[model samples]
Target: MSSAPVIGVAVLLVKGETVLLGRRRSSVGHNTYALPGGHLEFGESFEECAVREVKEETGLDIKDIEFVTVTNDVFTEAAKPLHLVAVFMRAHLADPDQLPQNMEPEKCYGWDWYNWKNLPQPLFRPLETMLKNGFSPFSTELN
Candidate 1:
């Protein structure tokens, strides 16, 4: 395996007190709740990747994309050790009336809004690492 860590961009699609998340069916974090995001592509900015991934995965357009934080996630305990640099971003729906659809059913079960204070169990590692480090997506200042 390549020694370099992969860069992942995860968007915290905020709506009031809730954020958009879906049950992942991917190899990295199977059966875990994850934000709308994916691997960053060549020459792609973080904001661009967030928007593109959200649209491609959930069929929703996002705006106000801002960098929140980054996590160095090293999954050393996995059957195949993996390392990822997860860049977290905060954004909102471009249209409030728009709803998220399961655009890639093969990758996610479906999208849903969940209260940040009471998120679903078994969060994806990067997200779980963020929460454990006291990162909150709601406030004007990083929490």
Candidate 2:
């Protein structure tokens, strides 16, 4: 019998017209740009997972974490099939003055702020799913 898919939480840290992203250097999405996130630990709430992952991967604290959407992410691993339930979320820096740094050099290149309209190419599968679905959490048109 196949096991259930694992849960991964992605947090989009918003700052004005930009959001934080990192270039993945590890397996699953190597060389692709993606939001800071990781597998959800057992008993961890989505918001808590978001906060923890953001800090773990970016050396940044994020607040205002909110659920946005979910994606059924399917990919390959070691020539085997893999599946994951990706939970998307939006958040803001808990300390606005704190800048993001590359906390895990093994997993990511570094963190950088990019405008929503001009995001870095080759997004992770879950993030690309959000884009193809027309989901925009950080719209600049907040009037």
Candidate 3:
């Protein structure tokens, strides 16, 4: 038997002082806040997938993507194993005036921009750490 294939993508979209976050509406961790992203389709490159997912979920066009970190989340949901490889990327919006449009009404409740100094409670740990620690734009990637 073969191991499950690596899939999924996550993005860290930043403006000057705020980061974008979305409230998930589906999956095992529904209603939780997560970075904007989703699964990669066949024949799509990671970068292309990232752009597509971000647009589809958040309705924002990402420009100049810089690779960041990788997160592997595997857990038992209802006694079945779920494996995900999340490719985290740092991207800037083409137009800061634009706002996130909730396309998947049932899958994502809403979107918000939180200041780096005042992030909401119960945030996704890794993303919180990234904000608190001050990610360097000059850096290529994070381990």
Candidate 4:
């Protein structure tokens, strides 16, 4: 609906060989698996946004947040045509033994850790695009 593309911060919260994700309950990507993130707030740095979003959505704190990559996604087939510039970031769990909880039930079904080699079905657009382009959060080299 908006004329300009919205900026989204997607955190690849890693733990060993797995990453945290949640099934979206929102209209934009309903039923799709996605990372813990949201729109980048005005004047907020990428790291701050990633940290805040993860805690707000998953009730898990993250650390070592670093920029990974970006994806320019345009969902023309969606019910409402949409464009998004997704900024991907990599991070690790602040507490290694801490489990993730569904902090925002209204927006996400729940959070879980899935192996990077085998992800859940029906991934969110930006995530899918990133995978298609071979962007791996576990790797140090940027793609």
Candidate 5:
């Protein structure tokens, strides 16, 4: 049996005490908060895809990135079994003040900075864990 392959990239973008998050538009649980990222296109490396996705979804340029964790999850969406390979990375913005003007209006409803200590409930689970644990992807424990 052949399974459909999907590549997802997520960024843990931090600026001092806050982290950047975007609301997913078409997820099973709509209005869920997640890090800025998306799938990798053909001929693109994961790192390049990560940088591009952050810019496309959040209008921010990233640098000095470090690989975090990788996960594989199988779930059903829209009545279809979906298999995903998710890659998480840590990145820093050159200038947080600069916003990109070309974000998709529907896909990205809005952006916000949340204190690492206090995050809203029902955040994208993995992202929340990353924030609460202080950005160490290599560590196994959630500290």
Candidate 6:
């Protein structure tokens, strides 16, 4: 039996021309950095998923949610074939004073802000797809 692609909601929390990202330590995309996001739960809207995932992973409140872009990611290196439909969205921290914390240290190293032009190495595949397609949170341009 074939399974459908998993839908994930990735949040682009931009402030001061930088965005929030975390180094993942899980089975998928281990040691690679990606935006703070997670699998979209049932009965949740895109914006709702974005807010929940950020809060779950970074303990940060986000606002000004807006649609960005979607990337179809496919990975077959793992035991089971994995595919993801990543929904990218732009948002800002509701409280500027709140810093991103590694709410789940077991799953992530920590969170930090990085310039769009100077992202950390070994980015997650979905994020790479975003960049390859010219998706920049700093600018409203996406190709």
Top-lDDT candidate index: 1
Query: 62-132, model 5: which lDDT tens digit per residue?
Result: 89787777666665653565676678887788776766443876886678777767766677655655555
Candidate 6 ranges beyond 4 A from true positions:
141-143
Q: Write the per-residue lDDT of candidate 1 for residues 1-143, one digit (tens) a residue.
A: 54899999999999999999999987778899999999999999999999999999988999999999999988876667789999999999999999999999999999999998999999999999999998899877975
Q: Rate the local accuracy (lDDT) of all candidates.
A: 0.93, 0.87, 0.73, 0.92, 0.71, 0.91
Residue 130 C-alpha lDDT in model 4 = 97
Off by over 4 Å in 3: 1-6, 124-143
Q: After superposing candidate 2 on the true structure, give the runs of residues whose Cα lies further than 4 Å from its correct spot.
A: 139-143
Using TM-score, rank the candidates from best to worst.
4, 1, 6, 2, 3, 5
lDDT of 2 by residue, 25-120 (tens): 976888999999999998999998998889888889888888888999778662456687999889998888999989899999999999999998
Q: Please, what are the lDDT tens digits per residue for candidate 3 over residues 81-141?
A: 5666667788899887888988777888788887766666666544544545566433545
Per-residue lDDT over 8-104 for candidate 6, one digit per residue giving the tens place of the 0 to 100 score: 9999899997999899998889999999999999999999999999999999999999988999988888667689899999999898999888899
Q: Using lDDT as the measure, what is the rank order of every candidate, best first?
A: 1, 4, 6, 2, 3, 5
lDDT for residue 68 in candidate 4, whole number 0-100? 92
For every model shown, what is its TM-score relative to the native structure?
A: 0.95, 0.91, 0.80, 0.96, 0.78, 0.95
lDDT tens digits by residue: candidate 4, 1-143:
66999999999998889998899998788999999999999999999999999989988888999999999998887788889999999999888988899989999999999999999999999999999998888775777
Using TM-score as the yardstick, the better of models 3 and 5 is 3
* TM-score quality measure for candidate 3: 0.80
Model 4 earns a TM-score of 0.96
- Model 4 bad stretches (over 4 Å): none
What's the C-alpha lDDT at position 5 in model 5?
Answer: 64
